[model samples]
Target: MAAVAVNSPPGHADPPPEGRKRPPGRRRIIPWAVLALWIAVLAAAVPLAGQLEDAQRDESVSYLPDSADSTRVVRLQEALPGGEATELLIVFSRDGGLTDADRRAAAERVAAIAGAHDPAGGAPRGVPSEDGGTELYPLTLTGLDEEEQAAAVEDVRALAAEGLPEGLTAQVGGPGALQYDQEEVFGSVDATLMLATVAVVAILLILTYRSPVLWLLPLLSVGVATVCAQAVVYALVQAFDLTVTTMAASVMTVLIFGAGTDYALLLVARYREELRRHPHPLDAMLRALRGCGPALLASSGTVAAGLICLLAADDNSASGLGPVGAVGILCSLLVMTTLLPALLVMCGRRVFWPLIPAHGSEPRAGRGWFGRMGASVSRRPVAILAGGVVLLGALSLGALALPGQLKSEDSFRDTPESVQAMERLTDAFPERNAQPILVMARDAAVPEVVAAAESTAGVADAEPARSGGGWTEIAVHATDPPESEGEEAAIEALRDRLAAVPGADAAVGGPTAQQMDLGETSRNDRMLVIPLVLGVVLLILIALLRGALAPAILLAAVVASWGAALGLAGLVFGPVLGLEGLDPSVPLLTFVFGVALGVDYGIFLMHRMREEALGGLPTRQAALTALRTTGGVIASAGLVLAATFTVLMTLPVVTLTEIGFVVAVGVLLDTFLVRTYIVTAASWLLGRRVWWPGPLSRRPEPAETSPAPAAGDGR
Candidate 1:
């Protein structure tokens, strides 16, 4: 192979011998100063970052809409006589029938729990199943905070299971037990996600860079970004009382690594190219930063803006994710743009090690894979474009198989004790409600509200449970099992009937109602937030690209990619993974990330294409040149980002797993298929029209000339 001079981009020219000297004293001082400043910042940030876990609020109330009826019910319930009670149901069941000894053991265990905890309700009475196969005991432990409630639930479970008969099993269920189980999942989420994400990102980086030292720089910068972002988020929570859930923190962790590393890859690639053009490391790095800096800023801004649109969501978790994610993106941008560049300059060219880019050494030429792909795509642009669109559309048909909102009991990958207990209760008490519907009304109209609730068509029982301040709480049980269609109808009927009571001001809520409210709010949020996210991203692309047609084309490709990702998820989530349904937040969150992140690769490819076009290349040659130059880095970036999200699939929570799966699929599609084939093909076919309304659209192609060697020829 013969080495040839790599083509300089656009107007760039080789530096004169004197101009290729070491950086001046001031220029050298800048990177050192920047490094010192970061060290000081990290010193202060470490302690604050450690406090982030303590600042997180994972309670169900933390995720509910601020003004929803369910949210109000929770607030009022906390004001009752005993603060907020931890309610649990104890179930003792046998496959065939409970013997007299089994019944005695169940009662004795319930009595022990009552004596130990001093439950608010006097003593729990056993409710036997008609088949004599199971018995249930309901109890409430009041005046307990979240920690105390978790402790109480565990204590009750231990007491209830003491010395159970061989054939009989005892399990705890209800709002309190369910909450404790959910808390357990979230308790380890941060550690689990961080470790998995770090491992995944490290492996991908090692593969992408193929240099141990080079991979460490990006990883280190991302780690710095994570700590700084967490510290910032913790401060926000302390000051503004932001709602930070386990989900938000976990997603933010992924974003910092995924998006931050993306910036590093683009900058590094450009730096490698500049190194071949300049003699000094600092000069090469400065040139690299100058070349790709705007694209980096624009791409990061687009992601941040899309995430910021989440502030308009009604669901607390969704809304909280907006700022938390935005903070993470900004922090990542700051670190990559500042700390990473300084580190690379300080480390000098040897960081690339075995494959260092020597000054004036031209790269060898070979038949590159991306170049071949571009050539193939260019040869049949229309056919390729139509085929890609049809293929994505075909994949999107899986959306029809998507199930409804996932039930709380089914939200975990493995059934916890609470869900197991609920399943047993459902089997044993087919006609009885395992959970009560809570109704709150003005104290003055408590009697009338109770009367209306009791007389409702599906009401099995309704009684005033507690009163405090100006409100009274009533417990209503339906005639059907929890979460069943019959039970849902009964709840609606009770609400309707209670609403008709003059001056009652009644609000209906409970475990089932909370799930209902989440689903409805999520549906409404999609309508508002999706459009908002798309608009924000579109505007950013338009501003960055300075073309209506190009931005529209990029947006459309990302949107189609999102649909294809969701459709694929729908197919896998149920038939392959055995999941019952999706979490209400899954679709909207995936769409936000899918579109925002997917567009990044398009930006990389198109920005390069635009550069080539501006440098006097014909449209067809410009498109192919851009693809040949940027394909490797974009593919590497897409893989890194996809793999980081894939780490979430290793988590036990079903919602996180679904989110990871969908986003990973979307990124892979965008990297290999959409950006590589569809976008490039469209550019080749549309020619300069892809940049309509921009100056490039009106400019004539330069006369045919000898093609310069491709930049980073062998990269």
Candidate 2:
């Protein structure tokens, strides 16, 4: 009989005994069949995935809360004459105050634009600033679709640039310009995010596996998952009219690579271990799946569940992210489990290259860094626990410094042309709201609505801009700057007074109104989605761990880490990075990701500990054993996940950058500090009680003979 492998070195797979191989039958055919099935599926999915960009709905109404006044206004406006008009403000300015030449030149440029484009109203006239240094031309370009509107804006900008007199700078600003910039950014997002994410994942995989050939398997599987996810999302959008935002699409990629690679890491590590015991690669893979499959399913399910809770959000953007993100995670889980295993089996033992797990060999025991750390932690459990708490608490204090909701102008890392134009408008029109307040009223109540708006305290002017489909559009200018406290108060007052008009179902909307709605909806979403995510995650943990105490401990540690991460972000975002304020959605996003992903490491640790305890080791010994054996893989997974999120920092959008930084930081903290020290110490201190209410929580029967092997022994 051939000797069975006890513990093999890393990456060296043992060959089967001579004349001892089992008959080759359906097993060999099965792997190639699975691989062929995936190849066919990938081919069919590529075309559908290519169409995903066409399904994106990035308009303001697409993101607004359904119950918000801005949303109502948008719906009503679409029913009006020529649909919603694209409004633009053209500003021509000179530093030393406008000369007669600059004024004449500005008028000529305005007339030139009027001639080239069909204006909704008559020819636009230049309205000079109070200081006489700037002239503004308000143009309403109506009766055009999205593409035509973009073309009109581009043409206007071109004319302004070409016709501007020397020393008089001109820019196109307003709703239309901002919308164009947003579209431009989103249009390129898929390519930029995909490329960066792929690069990051590939680098991490190469480093983690340290094999020229092994890293490609997971990356290829993840690629298949990504395309499949996109195809699914595309179908959802086409069939159900789902809203897909740039933020949601970008985040989907991050989740796929981060969560998918994490599962791959756990599976690969288990497969490597199994290789030492089972001579045939196929047998080893089966054993690996049996061991790690449940953990991967639970972890992915937890993340998907937490993300699905976003459907409760009032904001369309937030709600859309729920299903979109869930699909990505589920697809990744599907591909990684099925396709990855098949590929690994077919590739054979040599896929591991330099560090193959040869059968009948034992790994050196009790000498790894994780084992030493575990021993030290077991000796000073109380001290480690207290220190971890203090460290997390200290980091969390930074949350107090986090800035308020970010403004539109500060949305990007680098200022785009639209932002620059808006700034110029701000400087020239400090007393007047460059962006008009849009009010939709019943057509019958137009006179009353116009009168009330003009009589309002903060009203600079009110005019009936358009009327159709039983709705009258009133353009009102506030006396205060856009998004200022005074402007917000005015908007509220307008809504209040307009609501009182008989037969008028009026709704107030504009740039400022949208901001108000966004802020309110974000706050409401946090209240709703945060609890839902927590409940979902807690339930998943309980199911996976099959006990109460261990799940609770894991939950507590993860929640603390999330808070600490946010606090840390607050410090860096505002004080250090000099950002204006955080995006309102950042807190909720960070919470969901930090808790869901952070808990993953906890699951990896506690699951292994439970396994050790079940195998008859004492509670303290089990905890230490689990940590020593699983620590390296957990650390590697953490780094890979963190690196993927950090890729988001390369984007110009401030929101993505913030999400990336906070999530990446949170994952690292959980892996190194929370999982390595706090969880380990807490488990050691609790002993068997960590699995309370389960059979393992009770004392086991005494061993008949010799003491159990050292915690780090491969056995």
Model 2: residue 475 alpha-carbon error in angstroms: 1.4
TM-score, per-candidate, Cα-based: 0.96, 0.94
Pairs with steric clashes in candidate 1: none
The sequence of per-residue lDDT tens digits that candidate 1 reaches over residues 635-659 is 8888999999999898999999999
Q: Which stretches of candidate 2 lie over 4 Å from their true place?
A: 1-22, 699-715
Model 1: runs farther than 4 Å from truth? 1-8, 11-24, 704-715
* lDDT string, candidate 2, 1-715, tens digits: 0011113222234344454655577669878999999999989999999998878877778878989999989888888878888989888889889999888888888888888887877778888888888888889887888888888888999998785667889889888888888888777778999998999899988887789999999999999999999999999998998999988999999999999998888888777777777877787787678677777888889888988998899989888998999999999999988999999999988898977768765655554777778878977999999999998999899899898878877888888787787787778788888889999999899999999998888879889888887888889999887778898999999999998999998999998899899999999999989998988898898887788889988888988898898988987897777789788888888888888889988887887777666666677876777777788788888999999999888888888889999999999999988999999999989888888887777766334333234423232
In model 1, the Cα lDDT at residue 596 comes to: 90
lDDT of 2: 0.84
Cα RMSD to the true fold for all candidates:
2.5, 3.7
